[model samples]
Target chain A: MGYHHIHRYRIAFVDCDPAQIVHFSNYFRWFDTASREFFTACGVPSWRDTERGSGLIGTPLVDAQASFRNPATYGEDIEIESWVDRWSGKSFVMRHVARRGDTVLAEGREVRVFAVRDSVDPPVIRAVAVPAGIRAMCGD
Target chain B: MGYHHIHRYRIAFVDCDPAQIVHFSNYFRWFDTASREFFTACGVPSWRDTERGSGLIGTPLVDAQASFRNPATYGEDIEIESWVDRWSGKSFVMRHVARRGDTVLAEGREVRVFAVRDSVDPPVIRAVAVPAGIRAMCGD
Candidate 1:
């Protein structure tokens, strides 16, 4: 039901490191952008609706890690695969796989908590349950 | 005298969003990459010199919020300013400011901590003091 998600992007010139390789650091950035895009594609915006756009998530990261696989270069078209590997009452896990022409560049994951809701002016903070409605759309 | 610390970067094309605007999350990626570069420029290549490197920051975002002032477009030159804002014996803070042609795109920060230090297998990690040696060099 469109539960598992995978996103793809072309590695542009600016994505490369000084060594002319896609900097190891960039994989995370790519992972991040792709993940955000994944949600955006699903009609989910950022953590806040400060301007009052009303997004579904307002979470904080609790853990993250990335492992490098192969070197990716500038101007290479790569694919970033992202999915909700785990989603529970309080937290969710996202795994990202970045690759270039069958060559894997990096693999990573971020664990987060839907730890708050409402605004900070008066700060109506609360532990939010991962909405049951979104479950059928998640990966794991 | 070489102290590895966080530094910011100039946002490149790959750092933008579908709106062709500099997406809020791109700031985090640039900040992360820049911080890594700042450490490398200080001559402490973390991935290469694990013993002297700061090791993985394991930066699970405690909290991250940004204020977008102006829109930054693709290929537009942007400078991301970052610094160690606050440091405790247990943790340290890094602030990042992104600007394009005198206009501010977004301002945010990351809270990170070194988890250990000097290990043969698991890698050395610790919240070492913000080395005073390179403070002046990063400001520009």
Candidate 2:
């Protein structure tokens, strides 16, 4: 178990499809946002700040998965609870659950890596070892 | 194996993040669009027509997973190739591969089910058995 954070959102008209339910892709977006919020709640510095200090740009997703349970529509308010599920030497897993009222809407998991820009002229992203300090800040 | 369809898209500025790479969530969106294109290429009627004729509003996803192997940035032209991987009694699996030129960017899999609106006042979505005609049209 780890420290958890909840990110609240209101579904907008543009978030729904012709079927009048929230588009499935939006769940991934929400989970991503919730991950950021989780770090923020854990008192981690912004990615921009970390990038300047240690060349640690941000955590980039290597794998993502989601299971849709119930459908949501525009004008609905929902909350996503997120936390770190596990951490490895170079990557970590985050889990998120989305709900509207008492009904579960979706559950998501993401595997992300700490990344830095390579030294090439047109720099490419490369994964780096997970920094212990940042992990500690996440309160696992 | 099933009939395949390719959906090509040029990465947009807004599709990238501050890290200057395509946000992982966008890959799911592209994969989804490719699924619809796959159906179209297989000569299946549009979801609207199915809804009118057989109460089949659309194929909604129950589970989705993706693995990112490479990062893509704005202005890059990418193509997602999608096809049905398997079909069961009430659900089918769709597989998608996204590539930029010779480089593979991401691979995705989705489990989807045909859905119809329930008869409640505030109609809810419900999954139904795989429609034989639709499955045949998909050429699986």
Candidate 3:
């Protein structure tokens, strides 16, 4: 378990689909944002800062999944609670639960890896091992 | 299995993140669009038409998942091949494969249900059975 963080967001009109409910894809975007917020809360620096210092661009997702339990409409406020559920040598799993009031709207899981720009002409990215100091900051 | 459809898209500048690669979340959106395209290719009427006739809103996701295999960048053209992988009484699974030329970028699976607006104050949606006509049209 890692430090938990809650990210609050208002469902904008643009976030809703023609069906008048939040599109399922938006949850993944919110979960990704919440994951970054969790890292920031744990004293992890910005990717820009890390890139400057360690050549680490940012954590990128390798796999993602979400279960939608309830429908949410525009103008509703929602909260996503996020934390690192597991850490491996090269990747970590992030868990996020999105709620409106007392009802859980959705739950998301993402597998992400720290990455850097590979030395290729066409520009490629490669995953790197999870950094120990950053892991320590996020609570090993 | 159902009729397969390929949806093509060009990656936009706004689709990329600071990592200079397409954000993982965008893949889900593309997969979703491809699902709809698959239905359209099967001669299924639009949701608006269905709602007018059957009170059916649209297919809403119950579960969604994606695996990222390669990173893509802006200005690249990609194609998403989508089809129904499975169908049950109340829900169906959609599969999507995204590719850039010979490279497979990602694969996605979504479980979705046909739904209608429930008679609730704040607006609730409920899943309904898979319509036989739609299933036939989709080559179930």
For all candidates, the clash counts are 5, 0, 0
Model 2's C-alpha root-mean-square deviation from the true structure amounts to 1.3
Candidate with best TM-score = 3
Question: i-RMS values of the candidates, in order?
Answer: 11.1, 1.2, 0.9
Cα error of candidate 2 at position B68, Å:
0.5
lDDT for predicted candidate 3 compared with the true structure: 0.92
Question: Which of the two candidates, 2 or 3, achieves a greater DockQ against the reference?
Answer: 3
Task: Write candidate 2's Cα lDDT for B24-124 as tens digits.
Answer: 99999999989988888888888999889998989999999999999889899999989889999999999999999999999999999999998643448
Q: Against the true structure, what is every candidate's RMSD?
A: 10.7, 1.3, 1.2
The DockQ-based order of candidates, best leading, equals 3, 2, 1
User: Against the true chain A, what TM-score does chain A of candidate 1 give?
Assistant: 0.75
Q: Residue B117 lDDT in model 1?
A: 34
In candidate 2, position A129 carries an lDDT of 97
Model 3 in CAPRI terms: which quality?
high
